[model samples]
Target: MNSNSQAIKLFLVVAFSCTSLLASLTPVLAKPTPNRFDAKTILAQAKTFNQPPIPSGSPPKIRLRGGGKRAFNQPPIPAGSPPGGRVRGGAKRGEPACPTPKIDLTALVPFTQEANSVINVWGQTTVEHPSWFFYVPYTKDSPYTVEFVLQDPDANEVYKKAIALSDKPGVIRVSLPSTTPGLAVDKQYRWFFTINCDKQKNSPPSFVEGVIKRVNLSQPTLKEIETAEPLKRYAIYAQNGIWYEALTTLAELREKNPQDPTLKAEWRNLLSSIRLDDVAEEPILPGTP
Candidate 1:
């Protein structure tokens, strides 16, 4: 072969080899899309609250965590009312003005067809201390009261407490105290968080409600949860479709590690997956005990 022809051939061979090597490495070098906590994915992998063989087939054992205190002298709802029913009335004349109508006061529940603006949560729990979360808009330190009411499937009030809101506006979590009665297995309970913008009003328009049904976790899932690292536990909960526990775990983690970029990103992604981007960027403020 001529010298020039040989030189051209060598260059072409080297170029072809480099191109082939690059093509081979592309998949390895490409970044995998970050895992997002999608509700559908959770539903597929995790057992639903409605599943049989309920966990701890008894009432949830309540354990006081020294934060949420029960309200005293709160009147019980009259008997024969609908389950998850609330008394309705306009705000009384003299109370902290209601939040701007534009404010999106929402319950941080799963994005399901069953969930509406009224705030409906789902999933199962084995713990007596299940916490609920809400996205309260920035009211510049405006004081608010969150009245938590728990009712059985028949709508009879089982437990109710009105917690005072002292934290800055953001995502706030209210945990039920251990003193409260435990939730029975395989039974659905409805809860409400009424933001008493005006105490005088019988029922403020700004309120949320959700349903929770406790179920037993599979043996393998429980084992995995027991062995999973603290940070990884949220993923486990999410994968199992335990909405309350997963959100609570991640929220607690973010509260402790406010500056952690990874946790923050995970929080954002999780919330965004449910179309809660409006309050996704809101900081996880220190909630009132």
Candidate 2:
């Protein structure tokens, strides 16, 4: 062989040797084995493993030490829970804290008399005597005493009293003092109810932050009619005893004067609408006014 051919033969041999070495070094990766243990065997192995004991202490506990695998088991909660503590409301822990009682003045107004018959038209006649209605809801240990307070807009207390012992929600009714006989008709009032839960007093009675509903006995008065021109028409309608037209005219008047004409006429119509009992006809109408 010539020198060049001999060199080519030598190069071929070197390349084959390098390829063989590389093939030998390449790693043959093995496949992972599938877990084939039966359920019973797995359970037995879990039983054989030892679990670490729980570190017992007060709430907000922190774990500094490592612990072995264990099933989750919670501590039992005590009964007659005190304030500021979590109470269970459902299957979940620490939910739905106890609710506070809310006292509200549904209304405060004058006692109207249609021939000595007091009215509660706002309550749709379901309520009588027209006193202040307060709704109180409470849940606490036995013998809870709550105070109800009535005051003016200026924060001058008008009435205050303590109510005792209820395991559930309750309604409190108090008669409005007729100090000035008709003072309640147009005046604004404020009220609140405080609780002494388990003989431990809570925050002072909270003020009901809303307006008080007032009552008026007569149809929009003469002065009110001037503010709303349509009311004069309604008064004339009522005065003319045109019942249907007066009723139809109300819708138009209501848009202009919701306070005076519409409300007053609505109330008067309610009084004349439903007759609770039959009235006996006087043989001759008792002399007309």
Highest TM-score among the candidates is held by which one? 1
| 2-26: candidate 1 lDDT, tens digit per residue | 9999999999999999999999998
Q: TM-score of predicted model 2?
A: 0.28
Each model's total of backbone clashes: 5, 0
How well does model 1 score by local distance difference test?
0.61
Per-residue alpha-carbon lDDT of candidate 2 for residues 1-289, written as tens digits (9 for 90 to 100): 9999999999999999998887776544344456668798787775543222222221111111122111111111112221111011111223222243232212211111122332212111111112443334453364446565656546677666665534444333444444523225444444444444333332332222222323342455435434645545444433433322333344344434545643543534322222210110101111110
TM of each candidate vs. truth: 0.61, 0.28
Model 1, position 177, has a per-residue lDDT of 80
Extract clashing residue pairs from model 1: 55-216, 67-289, 83-155, 119-209, 121-210
lDDT for position 88 in model 1: 22
Model 2 scores a C-alpha lDDT of 0.35
> What value does the lDDT take at residue 137 in candidate 1?
64
